[model samples]
Target chain A: AQTVTQSQPEMSVQEAETVTLSCTYDTSESDYYLFWYKQPPSRQMILVIRQEAYKQQNATENRFSVNFQKAAKSFSLKISDSQLGDAAMYFCAYRSRGNDMRFGAGTRLTVKP
Target chain B: DAMVIQNPRYQVTQFGKPVTLSCSQTLNHNVMYWYQQKSSQAPKLLFHYYDKDFNNEADTPDNFQSRRPNTSFCFLDIRSPGLGDAAMYLCATRAGPQETQYFGPGTRLLVL
Candidate 1:
């Protein structure tokens, strides 16, 4: 079974600064996808960014990006220019082709003004 | 807006009582999923429906059941609620097997 692990339980970043949340996974499948999801206090889950295992270039979406290292089974999320709205519980998820998705325990991100 | 919607944002049920959570989607996606998330935990897959085909996770308890009457609606029925069953239930929908899933705001379930 594939599993995702987020080592940090909680993280804090100053306004306009950057923060990186670490994530690692255990998967034998060569073809898979990694995703970062944000769940705010409202309890609504929102997609942050995604990275395909076959892609060497890291995926970037505005201030959110991922450092996906397939060999190391590491997929970290980086939030640049962090804002108050970024405060939420961030989850790292994994999904193999034609399979169910799994998520990490989650990292609570706090943005400080 | 083509989004997933869950009814009764919050619910309180007594122990041994049965409860049902409803989910509807405007996206008209082919797949709908139900996930249970305990406090301070990740969401766990309960079951999913691909059109009319029901798929339950291997470890899901038999006490949990689901119904998808049509393309737009799905329901999660817990036969007997327990304190341990109290959690946030989330609903998600996707266009295809490997498509990105859009999640609903979730319903907070409290078993007393």
Candidate 2:
């Protein structure tokens, strides 16, 4: 079974600064996908970014990016120019082709102004 | 906008009572998923429907059941509610096996 781990339970960053949330996973499948999802107080889960294992280049979307190291089984999310709206519960997820997705415990991100 | 919709943003049910949560999608996707999320925890998959084919997780409790009568609507049924069953129930949809899923706001279930 594939499992995702987010070591940090909570994280805080000053406004306009950058924050990185660490994630690791255990998967034997050679091909898979990694994703970061944000759940705000409204409880709406939003996709942040995604990285394919076969892609060497990291995926970047607006201010959100991922540092994906397939060999190390690490996929970290980086939020640049953090804003108050970024405060939410961030989850790291793993999914293989034609399989159910696995999610981490999640990290609560607090952006302080 | 094409999106997933879950009815009753909040629900309060008594112990031993049965409850049903409904999910509808405007996206007309081929897949729909139900997840249970407790406080400070990750959302756990309860089951999913690929069109009319139901797929339940191995660890999912027998108390939980799902029904997908058609392509656009799915329902989650808890035969008997327990305090432990209280959590946020989320619905999501995907176009295909490897497509990005769009999530609903979720229905918060409170068992008393």
Chain B vs. true chain B: TM-score per candidate = 0.96, 0.97
The top-ranked prediction according to DockQ is 2
Measured against the true structure, the TM-scores of the candidates, in listed sequence, are 0.96, 0.97
Where does candidate 2 stray beyond 4 Å? none
Tens digit of lDDT per residue, candidate 1, span A8-89?
9999999999999999999999988899999998669999998889899999999999898889999999999999999999
What interface Cα RMSD is found for model 2?
0.9
RMSD of 2: 1.1
Worst 10 residues of 2 chain B by lDDT: B93-102
Show model 1 residue runs off by greater than 4 Å. Answer: none
Each model's DockQ score: 0.81, 0.85
Residue pairs with colliding backbones in model 2 are none
User: Each candidate's lDDT (Cα)?
Assistant: 0.93, 0.93
Q: lDDT per residue, candidate 2, B1-112, as tens digits?
A: 6388899899999999999999999888999999999988899999998888889999999999999988889999999999999999999998986688789989999999
Please give the range of 10 consecutive residues that has the lowest summed lDDT in model 1 chain B.
B93-102
